[model samples]
Target: MRLQMHAVKFTADQSLLDFIQAKLDKLDTFHDRIISGEVFLRLEGADSNKVKEKIVEVRLMLPGKELFVKEHDKSFESATDRVMDVLKDKLVRFKQKRNDISSPAIAEAKTRVDEEDEVYEADEL
Candidate 1:
């Protein structure tokens, strides 16, 4: 998966960037079809603001849909972790729902075919 990390208003250090990349890399294991991901880290204090105002936004791009989670914390790492956990759960559930929707008809057809095959075998005997 392609990951694009944008740190708004300030330059992010190499270690932090690497950490974000590693965290997001695990998301691909949940669903290999994920196209890309965008991480936006914005410091919300350009104007007069409080000290604990760091915002981290993660956007995940899939084949036909996009998932986004935004979180605020005292530190960017904490926010990133929280968002990643939420995204992981969401992705797992989405995959499960998609599989469930696609499997029922195939299962029913297979059962009918098996029954027909059993009848044909009995007739031949």
Candidate 2:
């Protein structure tokens, strides 16, 4: 999947970029269908504050839907981690719903198999 990183208002170092890239890459294991993603890193709150909160925003593009997550923490890494956790849950649920087989479909398949088995047994006897 293609990932675009945007460092809003500040320049991000190579290590931070690599770290976020690695984390986003792992998401493909959960949902390989992910087409692309965008990550926005920004510092929130006023500069007067001794410590500013790091905000991480992620948008994942799928086949027909888009998933977004935002998290803030004292560190960018932690915020990114939290965002990934939320995205993971969403991806898992999305996969589950997509792969779910309806009851009627299951029942129809079972009936066909049962009929075939019965016919085979009768022919044997």
Candidate 3:
């Protein structure tokens, strides 16, 4: 998957970028269909005393749908961690949804076959 990282109003260090890349790479384990992803890191000008002001937004592109997550923390690392959690959850849910849509028809067909087998046995008796 291609990852495009953009930092707004500030420059991100190599370590932070590496951290983000590592986190996103794990998403492939959940679903390999991910086409690409974009990460936006922004510094929000809020109350100076707030502990969480840095914002991280992640956008993931799949075959048919797009997933997005946004989080704020005191530092980019914290925000990235939170975003990774959300991305993992989203990927899991997406896989579950895809499986649910594909499994019901197969299950119904199997049930029909079982019913037909029972009828054939009854007629033979």
**Candidate number that wins on lDDT, 2 or 3:** 2
Error of 3 at 77 (Å): 0.7
lDDT, model 3: 0.88
Let me know the TM-score candidate 1 reaches against the reference structure.
Answer: 0.77
Assess candidate 2 and give its TM-score to the true structure: 0.79
In terms of lDDT, the poorest run of 10 residues in model 3 is 43-52
Which tens-of-lDDT digit does each residue in 99-124 have in candidate 3? 78468887898889898876456668
TM-score of each: 0.77, 0.79, 0.76
Ten-residue region with minimum lDDT total, candidate 1: 44-53
Among these predicted structures, which one has the highest TM-score? 2
- What is the per-residue lDDT of model 2 for residues 1-125, given as tens digits with 9 covering 90 to 100? 79999998789999999999999999999999999999999888646665579999999999999999999999999999999899999999999877777657777998899988764566687
For model 1, what is the C-alpha lDDT against the true structure?
A: 0.87
Model 2 lowest lDDT segment of ten: 43-52
| Alpha-carbon runs more than 4 Å astray in model 2 | 46-51, 103-125
User: What are the lDDT scores of the predictions, listed in order?
Assistant: 0.87, 0.91, 0.88
